[model samples]
Target: MRGPLVLACLTLLGAEASAQEVVKIGHVAPLSGPQASFGKDNENGARMAVEDLNAQGVTIGGKKIKLELVAEDDAADPKQGTAAAQKLCDAKVNGVVGHLNSGTTIPAAKIYNKCGVPQVTPSATNPELTQLGYKTVFRLLANDNALGAGLANHAAKQLKLKRIAIIDDRTAYGTGIAEVFKKTALANGVEIVDQQATNDKATDFMSILTAIKGKKPDGIFFGGMGPQAGPMLRQMQQLGLGKVYLFGGDGVCTAELPKLAANVKTIENVVCAVGGAALDKRAQGVEWKKRYDAKYPGQFQIYSAYAYDATMVLVDAMKRAKSTNPAVYAAKLFDTDYEGVSAHVQFEPNGELKNPAMTLYVYRGGVRVSTN
Candidate 1:
C-alpha cells in the first residue's frame, strides 16, 4: 500500500510541474562590443524583472507561469540587430526588451512587428523609431527630439554660447540627435561653426577637434555613445580644448563615461542629457537603485531603471490581458498605466511614453551630478 501511494504521489507531482507555463522574454543588445557595458546593464535590469516576476509567481489565463529571459548580442550593429530580432522571434518569445541603440532598435522594431512580438526599448531615443507606426513598438523614455532640443536649448539659452561645433558618429542615433541639435541651435541664433562626421567604431578625433578648436567655438556637441565620447574627451584635452563645454545626448551620458574619459579634467566640461529624471529625484528610484546596486554592484548605468520599467510594463500588459500570447498582450500595452521606478508608464497614441522627462547632468568630482 505504501509503494502504490508513493508512486501515485510522484505522478501527481510531475503533472503539477507540467501544468506551469514557461514564457520567454527576449532581450537584445551589444553584449560583446564597445557598448557591452550599457548592453549588460540593460540586460541586468530585464533579468532583475524576470527574477522579481518569478518570485512573485505569475499567473496568466488561470495557469501558473514561469518567466525566462533569452538574451542576444547584437554587437551594436544594425545587421546583427535584425538577426537577433529574428532569432528571438523564431524562439517565439512572448515579448522583447531592447536593441539599445537607435541604429539597431529601428531595424529590429520592424522584424519584431512582423513576428507579432511586442518590444519596449529602454534606451533607443531617436524619434524615427516610433514614426515607423508599428503598434508593437514602444519607447520607454523620451525621444531624441526632447534630448537634442533640450541640450541645444541649454547651450543657446542657459550657457549663452555663441558658437558650437557638432561631431557625429554618423549612426542613426548620432546623426538624428545631431541634426536636431543643429536645427534648434541655429534657430536659437547660435552659429554652428562646423559639423564633422565619423563612423561609430572610430576612436581618433584629433583631426576633427583641431578643426573645431580652430573655429574657437564655445561648445562642441557629440552625438554618439560613451565608448567614442570618452576617448573624444581625452583627445579634446590633448588638443587643448578642455575648457570648451562638451554637450551630448543620452548615449554619451553613462556611469562608465568618467572611467572612459580616463580622469581627464575635460570630463568636467561634459554636459549630457538623459531621457528620464535623475534616479535620485524619483520617488521609487532611490530605493530601487539601492537594490540594483546590491545585486549588480557597479554595473548600473543610465538605462537600467528604464529597462526594468520596460520589462515590468511588458509583464503588466501580459497580466492584464491574462494571456502571454503576443497578439493579446501587445494590445494591452497601449493601455499601460503602471508606475515604474523610472517614471509612470503611459503611452501616447504613437507608442511614445507620455509626458516623458529629461534630465541634464555634468561630472563633478568624477561623478555624475544632476544639473537639473
Candidate 2:
C-alpha cells in the first residue's frame, strides 16, 4: 500500500513537468567586452525576472509556463548584435530584452522587426532608434534628446556656465547626444569654445584634453560611455582642468565611473544625466534596490532596474494577451501603460517612451548622486 501511494505521487509530479510550457525570452548585451559589467548586470536582471516569474508559476493560455531566458553576448559590436538577434529569431523566442548600446540596438532592431519578434531595449538612449517606424521595437528609457537638453538647461540656467566645449566618440549614441547638447547649449546663449572627436576605444585623451584646455571653457561636455569618460576625467585632472565642469549624457553615467577616474579630484566636477527618475525619488526604489542587492550582491548599475522593468513589461504584456506569441502581444506593447519601477512605462506612436523622464546627477564623495 505504501509503495503504491509513492508511485502515484511520482506520476503526478512527472505529469506536471510534462505539462509546463517553456517560453523563451531572448536577452542580448555586451557580456564579454569593455562594457561587460553593464551587460552582466542587465543579463542578471532579466534572469532574475525569469526566475521570479517561473517561481510564481505563470499560467498563460491555460498552460503553466516556464520562462526561459536565452541570453546572447553582443560584445558591444554592431555585427555581433545583429548576429545575436538573428540567432534569437531562428530560435523563435517570444520576446527580447536588450542590446545595451544604441549602436548595437539600432542594427539589431531591424532584425527583430524583420523576424517579427518584439524587441525592448533597456539602456539604448539614441532617439534615432524609434524613428525607424518599427512597430515591434520599444524602449524603456528616455532618449538622448531629452537627456542632452536637460543637462544643457541645468548648465545654462542653474550652473550658469556660458563657455563650454563639446567632445564626442562619433558613435551613434555619442555623436547624437553631443549634437543635441550642442544645439541646446547654443540656444541657451552658451558659447561653444571648442569641439573635438574621439573614438570609444581610445584610452589616451591627452591630445584632445590639451586642445580643449587651451580654449579655457568653463565646462566640457563629453558624449561617450563610462569606459571612455573615466579616463577622460583622470586626464582632465592631470591637465589641471579639474575645476572645469564636466557634463555628459547617460552613456557616461555609471557606478564604475568614479573607479575609472581613479579617484581623481575632477570626479566631483562631473555631471551626467540618465533617462529615468533617480532611485531615491522612485516610490519603489528603496525596496526594489534592496531586493536587487540581495540577489546580485553589489552589482547595481544604472540600467539594471530598467532592464528588470523591461522584462516585467514584456511578461506583463504576455499575461495581458493571455498568450506568449509575439505577434499577439506586440500590439499590447504599443498600448503599454504599465507602472515600472523607474517610471510609468508607456509607448508613444513612434515607439518612444511616453512622457520620458530624465534625471541629472553629480558626484559627491565618489558616489553619483541625483540632483533632481
Candidate 3:
C-alpha cells in the first residue's frame, strides 16, 4: 500500500518575505512497495514542518521567509534515487531531507554532493554513507555499525545464543549491518552456523529456511525490509522452527509488518530492531499523533518524526543563514542546534548523530513495544 501521502504540489508562496527569494526544500524517498508507509510517513512529517515554519513568517535578514517542499518518489531504487537528486539539483532547490534506503542514499549522496545540495537522511543506517567524506550528505539516525554491535552484544552477552545464522538482503545497509553482527557475534564466541542472502522483494523463503533448518541454528538474523521479514517469520513458524528468534536491522521497522505477518498463519514470536524515535505514547508523541491523525488518518509509519525534524532543522538554518542560496545555508547548518521531535538534534563533523543512540523493539501481542 502507498498509504496516505501529503503530496507536495510544488507551489511558490514567498509573498510575505521581503527578501523575495523563494527557498525550495527537496524530499526524495520510497513512496511505493512494502516500505511505502515509511516514506509516506516521512513526507507527512516534512509537510507539517514546512507548513508550520511557513505559517510563522520566519524572517531572515529582515525578510519574512517561506519554506516549500518539493517531493519526489525514489521507489526504493538507487537509480531512481539518483534521478530524483538530479531533478532537485536541476531545479536548484535549497536543500533536501531524504533517500530512505542506504543503497539508494549512498549513490544519491554523490549526486547531491556534486550539486552542492545538502541532503540529510532520516533513516539510512549504512556507516559508509558518511565515510565517503561528503559533507553534503548527513544522517540523523544512528548507523548500522552501532545497531549491529548493540544486537550482537545483546545476543552474545545477554541472550547467550551460541548458534546464530546471519542473512542479508544484499543491499548496502543490509550487508554492512549483517557483517558487523557476524563479526561481533563471532568475537563473543557465538558460532556462525549459516549465512544466507535474500533480495528485498523476495516473498518465498522456504528454500532459505530449509537450508537454515538443516543447520539447526538457534536464531536467524535478517538485514532487510519488513516486507520480506514478515513473510519469513510466517514461513519459519509454519515450518515448526521452534525456539528460533528472528532479528533484523532497522529495515524491519514498518507499521505494516504485524498485519502482514498476521495475514500469514503461524507468525507470533518475532523480534525486530529499529533505529529512530520510539515515542512512548507520551503527551508530546500523543499530540503529534493526534495532529497526524487529524490530517492523515491510519497512515502512520516509522521515521516521520525524524523527517519532520530534518525539515524544521533545514528551515531553521535557512532562517539563521538569512539566505536561500545553497552555499550559505549549507554552511549555516553546521552552526545549528535545534530541539526537534526526535531529540535536541545536531550533527557531528562526519554528518552522523552527535550522540548516536538506538532503541530495541519487539512485537508483543501484535504491538511494537520498546524494550530500550
Candidate 4:
C-alpha cells in the first residue's frame, strides 16, 4: 500500500510539471554603448514586468506560464540590431520589447517581421518605423513627427525665437527630427541661420559651434542623444553661446542629461520634447514610478515606463489570445486596449500609438522638470 501511494504522488508531480509552459520574451537594446544607461533602464522595465507576471501566476491555454526575458545588446548599431533580431527569432522567443534607437529599431523590425515575431519599441520614435507596413512592428509612444513639430512650435511661438541653427547626428532619428523641426520652424517664420551635421559618436563640437556662433542665431536645435548633447552644451558655453536657447527632441530628453552635461549651467537653457505626458502628473504614472524607483533606484532615465507598458501590453495580448505562440498572438496586439502605466495602450493600423501625448521638459538646478 505504501509503494502504490508513493508511485501515485510521483506520477501526479510529473503531470503538474508537464502542464506548465515556459515563455521567452526577447529584449534588444544598446546595453554596452554610450546609450547604455537608457538601454539598462529599458531592460529593467521589461524585467520588472516579467517578475510581476510570474508573481501573478499567469496562465495561458489552461497551462501555467513562466515568463523569461532574453536580453540582447545591439550596442546602438543597425547591423548589430539585425543580428540580435535574427538571434531572437532563431531562439524562438514568443515576443520582443526593444532596440531603443530608431537606427537600430528600423533595421531590426524587418528581421522580426520576416520571422513573424511581434516587436514593441518603447523609445524609437522615427515615423518610418511604422511606415514600413510590417504588421509585427508596434510603437509605444508618439513618433518624431510629434516630438519635432512640438519643439519647433515652442521655439517659434512660445519662446519666440527668430533665428535658429540646426545640428543633426545624421542617423535616421536625428535626421528625421531635424528635418521636421527645420520645416516647421521655417513655416512659423523663424530663420534657420545655419545647418550642420555630426555623427552620433562624435564628442567634439568646438568647430561647429564656432561656425554657428558667427550666424548670431537666437537658438540652436540639436537632433541627437544626451551623450552628444552633453558635450555640445559644454562646448557651447566655452564658445560664449551659453545664453542661447537649446532646443531638441526626445533623443536629448533624459534624466541623465544634467549628469552627462557635467552639471553645466547651459543645461538650464535646454528645452526638449518627449513623447508622453509628464509621469508625475498622472495617478497611475506616479504610482508606477514609485515602484520603479524602489526597484531600480537612480537608474531611471526616460523610457522605462514605456518599456514596462510595452512588456505588459505583450502579455495582455498573450493572455487574451490564450496562447504564447507568436503567430497565434501577434494579431491580438493590434486590438490591444490594455491600461498601461504610460498610457492606455492602443495601436493604429500602421502600428503607431493612438492618440499619443507629448511633453516638454527643462533642467532646473541639475534636475529634469516638466514644462507641460
For this target, which candidate reaches the highest TM-score against the unseen true structure?
1
Report the poorest 10 consecutive residues by lDDT, candidate 3.
6-15
TM-score of each: 0.98, 0.97, 0.92, 0.97
Over 4 Å off, model 2: 1-4
Model 3 CA deviation exceeding 4 Å by range:
1-20, 263-268, 281-283
**How does each model score on lDDT?**
0.94, 0.91, 0.81, 0.94
> Tens digits of per-residue lDDT for model 2 on 84-108?
9999999999999988999999999
Better of 1 and 3 by TM-score: 1
Model 1 poorest 10 in a row by lDDT: 1-10
For model 3 the TM-score comes to 0.92
Off by over 4 Å in 4: 1-7
lDDT of 1 by residue, 225-327 (tens): 8999999999999989978999999999998899999989999999999999899998799999999999999999889898899999998998999999999
